[model samples]
Target: MNGGLIMKEVTNSDPFTIVGTEQYNMVSKMNREYRIFVSKPSEKPPASGYPVIYLLDGNSIFGTVVEAIRIQSKRPEKTGIVPAIVVGIGYPTEAPFSPHRFYDYTMAQTDQEMPFKPDGKPWPKQGGASEFLSFIEEELKPKIHQTLKVDSNKQTIFGHSLGGLFVLYTLFTSPRSFQSYIAGSPSLHWNERNILAKERSFMARLEREAIHAKLLIGIGELEKEHKSNIGELAKKMSERLSFYKNRGLNVKFIQFEDECHTSVLPPLINKSLRFSLHSQVDQ
Candidate 1:
């Protein structure tokens, strides 16, 4: 393994330790630095323009999802998936994930959601989701759209765990921000089911402004233990989705068999991608 050192050539664009992709460090006014990756498909985009998937936790899942899209989309006659651009929203850090993800990929909270240490130590700061969402809407989206000729009407966003929570939050608040939303094993118990309130508010918005988008909610069958909150969380999500499905939101629920919370992501990426783009390219 060359003593854990990379023996291959490296470049600034390949900073994510992956090839065939470009990485950039974007600094925001909120003092958060995002390590972004743009992975374009190998084949030429359709005349309708290429679809784009904005991924949270870019540093960890970017490579997996990007490669999945590339491989699956290679043979459309066999795999229904299509080649699309993947925009990963990661942070600059040697670790697998940055501490800032706790804050940036969460909903605004009031209480009952703080993470405390065993000895009751101060938890990491959180609840900066609004700001992070603004960064994506104002700064990141414009930058990406300006550079690439993307099919904005086919935009998709994928997130896992806490990032999944953020995906739901974004969908509820600004449904048009993306055409499809995939939330994998979301931490819905966060803030004592605070996301429900957001959904309630979104219901009111739906009355005034209609939304047309696809939503995929997936969770590992083994994600819940005896005392786990995942079951209740999923119930709330499913119930809420029931109300929105008739209002233009096409939703799907998947329970991955024989997979746990952490192990489900790699496998879910491919399925999520297909679900996200199926309707767009099926015609």
Candidate 2:
């Protein structure tokens, strides 16, 4: 079956709904559909409004994220960490699910075969990230702002794997777009470490100028998929860390010793939310 048909069937089987609150749904605009999950305070919308966390690959991670929020909000001491809304950009279960995402998440197309794809399908469309970023900034953000009681300055963006790569893209290209960024197991190998090069360029262009935002990067200690290249990745990350520190950017790195690529999401999400939440209090 086609991807759209599969999505329709899945939605029919298990419709979207907010678990604890009376708000949530699959929103559609301009041929794109997204699953938005919201969690509002019991009293009502606060005068200051709530913060939002936008998660890429929402269909896979929304439940775990929502559960984490529920557990965090129950604790009196941790109430500050729970965000008001967790928007998940749902993806169809097929090739080129969303042309925008497929393009944005990938790096530049290459002629060489990928380690993950042995059959070699022309490197999956990529390099339209600037335009994809525009879609979120110009289209999606406005929709959320108008519909929800969100604190304009407290928005965060998160991603994993290829999605994580795009998070970095946004961070460098549009640093002011999000107050915080969470990247879990990002594919730093994209475009032969083009992300690292871009970071260098960004730092060079803004030397000694502080970027007022929080960045958290996490990786599984046991993620040895490309064993020979692991040391290089660590070295690149270390270099980036030094650069960010010199620039006075708020940053954190976590290495989960027992986790793998797929296993890193839950803990990463928990830690990222905790960090973002605490930063709010510190401000």
TM-score for each model = 0.88, 0.79
- Lowest lDDT block of 10, candidate 1: 10-19
Residue-level lDDT tens digits of model 1 in 1-283: 5988879775556324555689889999887888998987777778878899999988888888877877788786688787888899998875678888988988666756566777898656888999999999999999998888799888999998888888999988889899988999888877545788888888888777668988888888788762457745865676678677667887777878888878889877878877876665221
Q: What lDDT tens digits, residue by residue, belong to model 2 across residues 1-283?
A: 5765654434446666656543344434345454454555443555777777888877677667777876776663745565457776655543323445666676565544455556754455667666666767887788778877888778889988778878877887678899888878777776555676677777775584667777777788777655545424744664575557555566677787789877888788878878776644232
Spell out the clash pairs found in candidate 2.
Answer: none
Best by TM-score: 1
Task: Quote the positional error of residue 247 for candidate 1 in Å.
Answer: 1.1
- Model 2, residue 23: what's the lDDT? 30
Whole-model alpha-carbon lDDT for candidate 2 = 0.68
| Model 2 spans > 4 angstroms off | 1-17, 20-43, 76-80, 92-100, 110-116, 228-235, 246-248, 280-283
Q: Quote the lDDT for 177 in model 1.
A: 95
- Provide C-alpha RMSD values for all models, in order: 4.9, 7.9
